[model samples]
Target: MKVAVYPGTFDPLTLGHVDIIRRGAHLVDKLVVGVTTNPSKEPMFSVAERLEMVRREIAEIPGNIDVVEFDSLLMEFAEEQGATAILRGLRAVADFEYEFQMAGMNQQLNDDIETVFLMADVSLQPIASKLVKEIARYGGSIDKFVPSAVAEDVRRHLGAGSR
Candidate 1:
């Protein structure tokens, strides 16, 4: 089976992420979404909370998709999951520079697995989890960047009124 790992912090699952998840599922027999904690950034949701939210967001996707939490090196985690490829979503040239370097490093670590990059849907290209949380914390409507359910979760966490 062709298994791929799409790993992200997913602090708040944005519409862009959902777009990638749906499209990524079609390219592999199983798409494992890894929710990893980034030590550099503080998270609004705990790993458990993120897992539940991710599960709810992907419940209806028509494929074999599952969410798991991993704290080790991504390549090692991908290997553990039996993934033949590591999937990523790109939105801009800036993103490409970073992802490209990371992909190259991962390849050096494990030449057996390939890294695949998917461009985010044009309309959702600007949506990012960091910016979504920043907008919510400052009282801006984030409905455009994330799903209604996710927007609500952000608002609730930030103690803001509904949009």
Candidate 2:
């Protein structure tokens, strides 16, 4: 089976994240959505919350996709899942710079697993979980960036109802 691991914090799955998940699924027998914690940044949602949110968001997607929580190195997680590829999405030049370095490091760790990049749809390219949280924090609508269900999740989490 051609398995790919799409790893991310996914604090709140955005349309861009969904876009990549949907598209990446077609390229592999299974797409493991690895939900992990980034100690460098404070996350608005807990690891459990993020896993549940990603599970809910991708539940309707048609593919053998699953979400798993990990706190160790990404390459180790991917290998544990039997993934032969690591799927990623690029939104802009900024994303490329970061993903590029990460991919290089991942390759060094495991040359057997290749990293694949997919560009988000033009319309969804601007949507990001960080920006979505920021906008909702300030009482702005996030319906455009995230699904209605996720928007509600964020609003409920932030107690910024119906903005």
Candidate 3:
């Protein structure tokens, strides 16, 4: 069976993320969403919270998708999960440079694993987890930026009531 690993911090999975996850699911027999911690940025949500949020968001998606948490290198995680590819989302040119560099390094580490990039939907292209948290932090409406399940969590995390 062909398996793909979509690895990301996913502090709070946004609509753009959902778009990618939905599309990536169809390309592989199984799509494992790997929620990991990024040492470079302090996340607003805990790893467990992120995993739970992603699971809830994808529970109804029509595919063999599962959520997993990891802290080690993505390549190692992919190998451990028997993944044939690593799925990533490309929202804009800004995302390409960093993803490109990481893709090269990941390839060097494991040539057998392929990296697949899926462009975000036009309407959801600007959505990002960091920006979503920022908007929510300042009491901005995140209903359109994230999934309904995630928006509630974001509102609660930011200490805001129902919107």
Candidate 4:
């Protein structure tokens, strides 16, 4: 049973996030979507809200897929969750640079764990959670860049002016 953990803030899962998860799903027996709570980063949605939104978005994903929230090092989280690998989504060169560093660190922390990178779908390459939230905050429609569940959550959050 090969399990892979995909960790991210997932402040609001974007279409790009969905694209990567769907692609990574085919490569692993189980995929755990780990939403992390970053202290420095102000999230647009609460952890519970993000988890619910992810559940709604990935409802069609195979039963092997799981959604959870965490606030710890990626390597530690993966080990605790019994994940044998880490899946990362690379959208551009900038992403590669950052993921590369993190992958190296994770490898150092846990030799049994490996990191796999999946390219984001071309159509969603430019979409990001931060950008989606920014656009929606200014009253711009992100209908195409975000999943329906995420869009609804974004709309609800923005409506109440809660960040």
lDDT string for model 1 (32-149, tens) is 9999999999999999989999999999999999899999999999999999999999999999999999999999999999999999999999988999988888889999988889
Better of 3 and 4 by TM-score: 3
| Candidate 1 local distance difference test against the native | 0.94
In model 1, where do residues sit more than 4 Å from their true spots? 160-163
| TM-scores, each model vs. reference | 0.97, 0.96, 0.96, 0.95
Judge candidate 1 at residue 85 and give its lDDT.
Answer: 97
lDDT winner between 1 and 3, please give it. 1
> What is the C-alpha lDDT profile of model 3 across 1-163, one tens digit per residue?
9999999999889988888999999999999999999999888888998988999888888999989999999999999999999999999999999999999999999999999999999999998889988888887899999988788888887774432
What is the clash count of model 2?
0
Give each model's whole-structure lDDT: 0.94, 0.92, 0.91, 0.87
What TM-score does candidate 2 get on C-alpha atoms? Answer: 0.96
- Please tell me which predicted candidate would have the highest lDDT against the true structure: 1
Give, for candidate 3, the lowest lDDT window spanning 10 residues.
Answer: 154-163
Scored by TM-score, the top model is 1
lDDT of 3: 0.91
